[model samples]
Target: MWQIAVVLFGVANAVQVDFRPYDHSAELLFNGSDFNHDHIFSRQELEQEFQKYDADGDGRVSRHEYTTYVTTSVPELHDFAHALYDDYDVSGDHHLDHHDYDMYYAKLDADSDGSVTRQEFVDYWVKLFQATEHLHGHGHSGHG
Candidate 1:
């Protein structure tokens, strides 16, 4: 029951989606700089990043843990981060397990066949990067 305020490109009206923790988690994969401007994350990178937040060593990042991650790692998103976690409790089981993570990836399944191919996954992240770049105006900022 979290509402994510998303501004659609080329649309005057804004829409709210059932914001999920995966959305914020995925968004955080971008570096917003020269280090990883393309937002291309290899499997190892994803695993390493996930491992950093999966504090309990339970192979899952719960809502409380994700909230802490967002507040500390990406404070800019703190205001709405908790809502995203709440919305992701798809099973009403109160925990975001591996199935929830897989479901998030399944969302990028363009063909809607219940799985994401390598191309689809890559393309989705690329498109996300491009859109972010566009929204931020043209180029990546460098820390010199």
Candidate 2:
């Protein structure tokens, strides 16, 4: 689903991929900066995110609770997290790797801003999902 695609995009962008042909930008991204894209989130940004979700002032988010909240809230991103856990959790460690993060980062950060602002990330995926959803919803009506 769109959720899986979006998360994959984000994680991929955060991690660099080995390019065989080496297109212009892919070459740059593959070799550029840290090649790990560690600058995805600043401490300020993470704190802000925590503030946004930690509505009860509990100062913590458990894995189950956080996953539910995100999935229910977006309705589209639940599949994304699931896919991330499935594909990129290479060692079955139930966690993401820097390579995964780099790959996701590159795909989502269209503007190459070095950081994915939330709105940018959402907008990028929203358009992708909507377009794909329309294509999926299309039917020939048995008339074609």
Candidate 3:
């Protein structure tokens, strides 16, 4: 009887485990950026979205501005903002401008297409978060 109970407990634990990665921040970002409610994220929409992070109307997003915006707007992602900012700051100039946005957009587009679908956006961000979490040995518990 004890062995049977132990087996049932193991099955319950297995059922509770989810290996799939989900990033709530990515979902929020996709919803916010899909301004036209068209399900697809176009480059124009992305450019407009990126502008919000500039904060100072400087046509560029500094590390401080980016961090502050993420912390305040997407608090759940605040922990990974630095990593995301670093990834987007391709030029290593500590500021994100059109060049960086363009490059990042291209990356998110995934298929060299001009637009990004919700799946592509979420998948990329989830992978990024997973990589960051692995590096830091911590997990983000935010759920969408």
Using lDDT as the measure, the top candidate is: 3
Q: TM-score rank, highest first? A: 3, 1, 2
Off by over 4 Å in 3: 1-25, 73-79, 134-144
TM-score of 2: 0.30
Residue 77 error, candidate 3, Å: 5.7
Q: Where does the lowest 10-residue lDDT sum fall in candidate 1?
A: 1-10
Against the reference, the lDDT scores of all candidates come to 0.47, 0.40, 0.67
RMSD of 3: 11.1
Model 2 superposed RMSD (Cα): 13.3
What tens-digit string does per-residue lDDT give for candidate 1 at 26-80? 3533332113344443333333444555679897777778777765633434445
Error of 3 at 100 (Å): 0.6
Each candidate: how many clashes? 0, 21, 0
Q: For residues 21-66, could you state the per-residue lDDT of candidate 3 as single tens digits?
A: 3456567667877889999988888778778778899899999998
Give all TM-scores, in the order shown. Answer: 0.44, 0.30, 0.70
C-alpha RMSD (angstroms) for model 1:
11.1
- Candidate 2 achieves a global lDDT of 0.40
Candidate 3: residue 75 lDDT (0-100): 46
> By summed lDDT, which 10 consecutive residues of candidate 2 come out lowest?
1-10
